[model samples]
Target: MSTTTIRVRAPSEVDDARTGPATGRLRRRIADNLTAYGFLCAALVCFALFSWYPIIRGILLSFQQVNFVTAPEWVGWQNFATLFADPLFGVAWRNTLLFTGLALVVGFAIPFAVAIVLNELRHAKAYFRMVVYLPVMLPPVVVAILWKWFYDPGPGLFNSMLRAVGLPDLAWLDSTDTSMLSLVLVATWAAMGSATLIYLAALATIPGELYEAAELDGANLWQRLRHVTIPQTRFVLLVMLLMQIVATMQVFTEPYVMTGGGPEDSTVTVLLLLYRYAFTYNDFGTASAMSLLLFVFLGGFSALYLKLTKSGG
Candidate 1:
C-alpha cells in the first residue's frame, strides 16, 4: 500500500545531467592535450636548434682538421690517436684521477661527518647551520684568490703563521708535491658547506620517535647514530656522493687559476688539458676528441648512478 504511489524519473534526465558535463570535460581534455603537444613540439624545435646542432657539429669537428680561413678536412681518427699519444695527456690523466680520489676521501667524508654532528646539536642549530652553509654563497673565483694569497710562497698568511710559530714555512701551492693537496684542501673547504646543508636536511627528515625509542632501549649516541641515523640518510648520501664524483671529475678552474696546471703539470686535469689543446695549441680536432672521451667517462658514471638508484629503491 505504501509503495503504490512510487514515481520513476526518466533515464534521459539522469543521462543528460552526467553525460553532458562528462562529454564537455572530455572535449576540454582533448583540447588541452593538443595545446600541450603543440608546446612540446616547439620545445623540441628549440632544442634541435640550440643543443643538438652544436653536439652534432662538435662530433663532426672531432673527425676533421681546419685552419681559421679554410674548410675542415676529414682526418678520420688521427686526432684521437695523436691525443692518446701525447706525453702530457698521460700526466694529466693520472693527476686528475688522483685529485678526484683525494676529493672523494677528504672532501666528501668531512662534510658528511660534520653534518651528522650538526644534526645532533640540540641548541644553536640554526646559527650552526648558517655558519656552515655561508661559504657556499662565496664565489669560486674569490675562494681561489683568497687561497692563492694565503698560499703565497713568502709573507703569506699560512707560511707567515708557520714562521711566526717557529715552524718551517712549507711551500703550500708552490711545491709540486703539495700543490694538488693545497688545491684539494681549498676545494674541500668550499664544497663541504653545501654538502653539510644537504646532510642536515636529510637528517632532519628522520623521525624523532625512532631516536626516542632507541635512547629508551639504552642505545648510546654512537649506537643510535650507527643503527638509526646512517641507515636513514644512506640514500641521500649515495646521491650526493655520485653528484660530487661527477663534479670533481671535471675540475678545471681551481687548477687553471691557482697553478696554471702547476709547477710540473701536477694539477693539469683532463678538462684543463682539453682547454690547452683547444686554445693554447689550436688543435680543435684533438680537443674535441678529448671532450668526447670525458663525456663518455661522465656518461658511464651517470649510467652507474641510475642503476644503483634503481636497485636501492
Candidate 2:
C-alpha cells in the first residue's frame, strides 16, 4: 500500500514539473513580444517625424519653385534641367571628385600609415598619439583661422618660412590653382585623428599569433605588413575609404571659410553650391535638386562598395 502511494505521488510531481516549465515559457514569450513591439513602435514614430518626413518634403521641394513667402509652383524637371545647364554645376562636380581623390591620397593614406607606425612603436606611444591628435581636437573655426593666417601670402608663417629657406613664396590659398590643394591639407590635418584612432583599434584586433607565425617563417617587416597586417585590416581599410569618399564629397566649411568658393569659383564644391542656392540666392527648388543629385551620387558609390565587399567575401 505504501509503495503504490509513493508511485502515485511521483507521477503527480512529474506532471507538475512539465506544466510549470510550459507556463513559464509562455510568459517569457509574451514579455519578449511586448518589448520588441514597444521598441518597433517607438522607432517608427521617430522615423516618421524626422527621416522619412524630411526626405519626402525635400523630394517635393525639388519639383517645386519654393520661395519662403509664396506657394510652391510645380516646375516638373525644370530644376534638374537648370542644374545641368548651369556652368557652375560642372565646376562643382569636378572640384568634388578632385577633392575626394586628393583626400584619399593625402588624408586617408597618411593617417592609416601613421596608425601602423604608432602600432609598431613600443615607447612614448601615448605622448606621440596625443601630439598627433591635438590638431584634430581644436575647434574647426580655430583651425580655419590659424590655417588662413599661415596660408597668407604676405608675412604669413608658410611664406615666411619659404622665404627664409630661399624658396619661392607661392600663393597657397590666394591662387585659384592651389586653393583646393591648400584646403585639402588643412582638412587632412584636422581629420587625421579620427582615422588614426579607428586604424589603431583595427591594428589592435589582429591576432598576435599571426605575427609570431610570420616571424617564425623569417618574414621581414615589409613581408609581414603585406601578407598579415594588410589582410587582417582590409575590411577596416575599405570602410575607411568609403567614409573618406563620403566626407570629402560633402566638404564645405574649410573652403567656405578660407576661400569663400573663390579664386574664380575654382574651389566651389557641391555643398557650397547648395548653400549658395538655398541661402545666398533663395532658390530652394534648385538647392533641393542639387542636394538630391549629391545624395544619389553618394548612394550609388555606397551601394557599389557594399556589393564589391560582399562579392569579395
Candidate 3:
C-alpha cells in the first residue's frame, strides 16, 4: 500500500546511470593507448633517425653525385649506368651467386644434418652443443685470422695434416679454383653453429608422436627424414635458406681479410665491390647506386619468399 507514493526517475537519468561506467572505461582505454604510444615514441624516433632516414638518404644519393666538400648534384641514371659499365660488376654478381649457392649446398645442409644427429643423441648433448657453437662465439676477425693460418700453404694445420696422412697438399686459398671454396669453408664453420642450434630448437619442438607414427608404418631413417623431419622443419629450412642467400650475397670481410679479392678477383663479392666503389674509387654516387640495386634485389627476393611462405602456409 505504501508503494502508491513511489516516484519514477526520468528516462534520461536512467540512461545516464547506465552509461557512466562505460564512459569511465572508454576514458581509461584512451589513457592506456596514450601511455603505450608515449613509451613507443623513443624507439620510433631512433628507428627513424638511424635506420629509415639512412635508407631514404641512400636512395636519394643513388641519383645524385656528392662529395663531402660540395653540394649534391642530381645526375639522373648516370650512377647506375656507370655501375653497369664497370667490369667488376658482373664478376661481383657472379662470385656472390656462386658463394650463395655453395653456402646453401654445404653450409645449409650440414647444419640441419648436424642438428638431426644431435637431436637423436642422449649423451653429452651439452658438450657437443658447446663445441658446435664455440666458433660462433669467437670474434669474426679472430675466426678469419685462425682460418687464414689453417689455410696457409706451409706449416699450416690443414696442409700439415695432409702431409701427415700422406695426402697431396692442396692450396686452400692460394689457387683460384679453391679460394672461394676456402672462404665458403671458413664462413660455414663460423656460421653453421647458429643454424645448427636453431635447427636443434626447431627439431625439439616437433611432436615425438610423429616420429613414432612414421616408425610404426615401417619407415626407415631416410623415409622418416623425408616424410616427417624435413616436412616438420620445412618452414625453418626455407627461412634459413633465404637468410643464407641474403648473407652470402653481402659477403665482404672474409674476402677482404682472407684474400683481398685475390687470385684474379675470384673472391670479389658484391659488398666488397661496393666497398671499393665507395673507398677505393671515391665514387659515393655509384656506391649508393650499387647499394640501391642490391637492396632492390634482396627486397624482391624477400617479397617472393613471403609470397611462397604465405601460400604454403
Candidate 2: tens digits of C-alpha lDDT, residues 1-313: 3554444457756766778977767877999999999989988999999999999999999999998889899999999998999999999999989998988878887998899999999999999999889988899888999999999998899999999999999889878888989999999999998899899999999999999999999999999999999899999999888988999999998888999988898899999999999999999999999999998999998999899998998
Two-way TM-score contest, 1 vs 2, winner: 2
Model 1 scores worst on lDDT over the 10 consecutive residues at: 1-10
lDDT of each: 0.88, 0.92, 0.92
What does candidate 3 score on TM? 0.92
Clashing pairs in 1: none
49-73 per-residue lDDT for model 3 (tens digits)? 9999999999999999966568889
Number of the predicted model whose TM-score against the real structure is largest: 3
Clash pairs detected, candidate 2: none
Local lDDT at 39 for model 2 = 85
Please identify model 2 stretches exceeding 4 Å from their true place: 1-24, 36-44
Query: What would the per-residue lDDT of candidate 1 be over residues 1-313, giving only the tens digit for each residue?
Result: 3556666768966766677987867877999999999989988999999999988888888888854557788999998999888999899889988999999988988998999889778899899888888878899988898899999977689988898889998888879889998999989988889899888889889999999999999999889889999899988988898888888888987998899997878999999999998898888888988888888889997998889888977
Lowest lDDT block of 10, candidate 2: 1-10
TM-score per prediction, in order, is 0.86, 0.88, 0.92
lDDT of 2 at 33: 100
- Per-candidate clashes come to 0, 0, 0
Query: Runs in model 3 with CA error above 4 Å?
Result: 1-19
lDDT of 1: 0.88
